[model samples]
Target chain A: MTAEEWEDFRKGHPKAASLKTVPLPFPELCATLFDGNAATGNPSQCLKLQHSAVIRIQTSRTLEEPKEDNMAKFSIATVFIASISLLLTLTHSFSLENPTDRRILVLVDDLALKSSHSIFFSSLQARGFELDFKLSDDPKIALQRYGQHLYDGLILFSPSTERFGGSLDVAAILDFVDSGKDLIVAADANASDLIRNIAAECGIDFDEDPSAVVIDHGSYAVSETEGDHTLIAADDFIQSDVLLGSTKIEAPVLFKGIGHSLNPANSLVLKVLSGSPSAYSANPKSKLSSPPSLSGSSISLVSVVQARNNARIVFSGSLDLFSNKFFKSTVQKAGSSHKFAKSGNQQFATEISKWVFHERGHLKAVNVRHHRVGETDEPAIYRINDDLEYLVEIYEWSGSNWEPYVANDVQVQFYMMSPYVLKTMSNNKKGLYLASFKVPDVYGVFQFKVEYQRLGYTSLSLAKQIPVRPFRHNEYERFIPTAFPYYGASFSTMAGFLIFSFVYLYSK
Target chain B: MGRSPTTKDDAQALFQSLRSAYAATPTNLKIIDLYVVFAVSTAVIQVVYMAIVGSFPFNSFLSGVLSCVGTAVLAVCLRIQVNKENKEFKDLPPERAFADFVLCNLVLHLVIMNFLG
Candidate 1:
């Protein structure tokens, strides 16, 4: 009936005292408390009392008397409760549940940057990221507290701070990166040695001359005053649509920063924006001293590293590259007359920020499964030369909702000491990647390895250990037709032996 | 290279002389010779068969050929021991030699059966 009548009926019952005092011991009874109709709010108070009255009788009869009528009702109630929770979990599973970066700690050299770079900061905020801005020398600053990382990503815009304030240091930041946390580092003309060391650890070498800035005489942006040619209109960007969004950046970006060179030994690091062929890194104020160490297109203005653990980091030579001034500026290259209303700085910064924060180009492989061709369940060990199929669901986090990652380049390796079978997997365009191959004839412990490292996407390295065994004694074929002659020959020799012995012994 | 007909004549003369000399061979020795030839021919047949077919069942091939060759070798040893002309094994009793031959044949056949797979 109504909640008031249900409550009154429960209180009027003779066993109402025990029902009120006794706790709901079984989980089945506990579920009634949640049936407060989650769709509508707080009527569950009276609704719980009403539902519990029915559940109480069901439990009492089943525990003591075992009546069929109440047992049936109790069973139906259990099904209802299970469906409710199943629906809850099903909806949760469909939500964006991947490793998209959420919390970030932004360390700034000065408080003025918070206002100067508010446009870029607001964009990050609008994208549902929680940014924690603090001065570099804040004594209480910490990347971690009590062995728990405070943020999923770190932004170091404090290039001039010689040393980080509290527990944040070179080793702590590197450890954060090693733990698969993302980072963003921006350095400028006055970049301290501490900032250089941090960049060096990430396989980059900034210009040794502290005062040097990238000077491109050929493509310097035309300003109101003819300033030094350090402010270049650089249009050289990496040709990855995934790294830089699919929309081509037409206008050259205004860049005023020092340049760095990526170490050749580090394959993980790549230059996102490089200087035009005529650009060089040298002190704009001083006369030409021994040809500039970093010159031409080799000078990297912006670089990104995807570490082995898939921790992405963006290293820009200019902090102003992320400032509102550059994002709002109109630009014209010196020689050419084509001027744009806005620079490409904002688009570049936003897309790179998305990359660094794992919004775009993040890949995850799930449900790695392998079984025999005819079977559905995975076996503990495989016999040598068994034809089997391997399947994995690979979905790229499309900077958005989880959609199917359709690519033909993914490969699976049946690896022992070396790869025995390396096959490119076929996909269904709906995220299911599969390959069928025969187990190697040789038997040993082997691994199903997927090492996917593409240019812009986060690499997916997965290995599942599987053991291969040679055939058991009875598993071998009992009678082969080709060996029949051998069997015949052997038997004939035995018969000959018998006859020869008989003739030899009975000769006398 | 041009002496084909003359070589055939020479081979026929060699065969004639050998048959004349072997005619005086003891009857029991002739029986042993027949048994040895049987085993040797069986082994040769198996080798030819293996050449035609691939050696896929290698263990079976080895066991088959070895059993026949081994029986022929043992039969020859028995013949030498029992022969009156073979002075090398003269002191070896024919009974002991025959017993040795039977035992060796049993062991060889056992091994062949085990490897026949």
Candidate 2:
């Protein structure tokens, strides 16, 4: 249309006419281009300019492209693929929902341990771990930044680094685990005070003598080159499939380092691997002195602490537990003839890592509902003496799927000052548990409570408070059988009054 | 029996004069007084019965006692208005007083009956 005709159209429909407009020829060309039909007419000067505009854009984008029959693009494509694959591998190393010491930050006093302990480092890498080896004195070994965590797990391999460099210290490590992370701490003959302090906070006390190494003469892994027999073989692990996995350990765990005593006051910590009755912690190289402070079964070879916040920490007296030499070494316990092909380090580390990473011991409760019998909707308030049925569905996270949490000890309480009715709930095997009961006759305020604490599982404490009210004045029973005598007396008195009035009027 | 004849004669004469004065009252007022006495006696009997039986139905006991007491009060009001010797109530007619007494009794009995149960 002509410009004057378009202006006239705009005047007639002002609301629609306010939108932007393009020239007729340009719109016609766009319609043709969108339809994929090239204009057939002689090439106009404007069409040529549009063609050059499209060509200029394409040429500029491909200007840096190598002219090797698309081999350059193939290389770039491979680079993109490799970058994505690397990212996937890195993320798979450390995890939140499942625990693993995959992407570990190995702090060391000297860089020599990287090569000297290459067996340990290589074993870790072979097991799909990305070990970021940093000298303990590195100025950039920060565990967190601005209250945001940087790692899902931490490993302190530096036993003698007196004080960590940068912002990392005892408090930073503790704060990491406090926020529900995993940790593996290994201390040797001369562990730093900072490491000891961290261990003490988790209810473990390393050997007081800075030079003491756990010397087990009676239970050491029998070797041809045995000197002090301090290299012990421990087979007595804590018997728990949930904690250590269902597979039994066939070989004994080899330990050779300082022993620690778990603090009696800390109940959350447990000794997974305990010292044999004959074992004692005293520097074997030094001459005998007074009785050792830590001896006998009180000394824990390897202990684990599952904090109240579900942070899993494994504290080992020996860094050799992670070494490939120990994992692959043949072991024969002292005074025993049965020889094993390999030690228990590999299986023990892998199973414990799965547990610490939240692949186990994670629970979630949902679908909590309560109502009177035969009712679907939960009421805001319940009347005293109401027959109520409370239902709660509890499921545990089985790494990938939710499974029914089953236990006979799960109980429900109808609580007012204390529980008036404590009943063991019955489950339907599908995780839906129901506790049916009559509301107490006494009314004020009441609560439904469930406190489930199992041996190895995380404790579940849940309570829902709901008020119970007495019946209203009109709502009371209109005629109760028990109250019939009282009613009879009232009516008889009125009848007697009527009769007495008649008798008095006539007799007088 | 052993007193002097003159002292005995004086006591007898005093009681005889009091009896004659009471006998001079109107028959309608005397009837009202008899009704009041009946109501009061009924109230006393009920109270004694409640004490022996135990007040398990306390509401019934209250209604029974109040009914008797209310009747006696209404009868007393009737007697006062109808008595010719009472000059202050001379404007009040005996029929009007009886009608008021009957109306008040109706109201009191209604409340007592409701409270009885």
- Taken over the whole model, the C-alpha lDDT of each candidate is 0.89, 0.77
lDDT of 1 by residue, A123-240 (tens): 9999988899999999988988878677889999998999889998999999999988999999999999999999999999999989889998899999899988989899999999
Q: Mark the regions of model 2 whose C-alpha exceeds 4 Å error after superposition.
A: A1-133, A497-508, B1-117
Q: Which stretches of candidate 1 lie over 4 Å from their true place?
A: A1-97, B1-17, B87-91
Best by TM-score: 1
Which docking class does model 1 fall in?
medium
Q: Give a tens-digit lDDT track for model 2, residues A224-245.
A: 8858978989877888877788
For candidate 1, the iRMS in Å is: 1.2
Query: What value does the lDDT take at residue A237 in candidate 2?
Result: 86
Task: Choose the strongest candidate by lDDT.
Answer: 1
TM-score for candidate 2, residues paired by index: 0.65
**Cα lDDT of model 1 overall?**
0.89
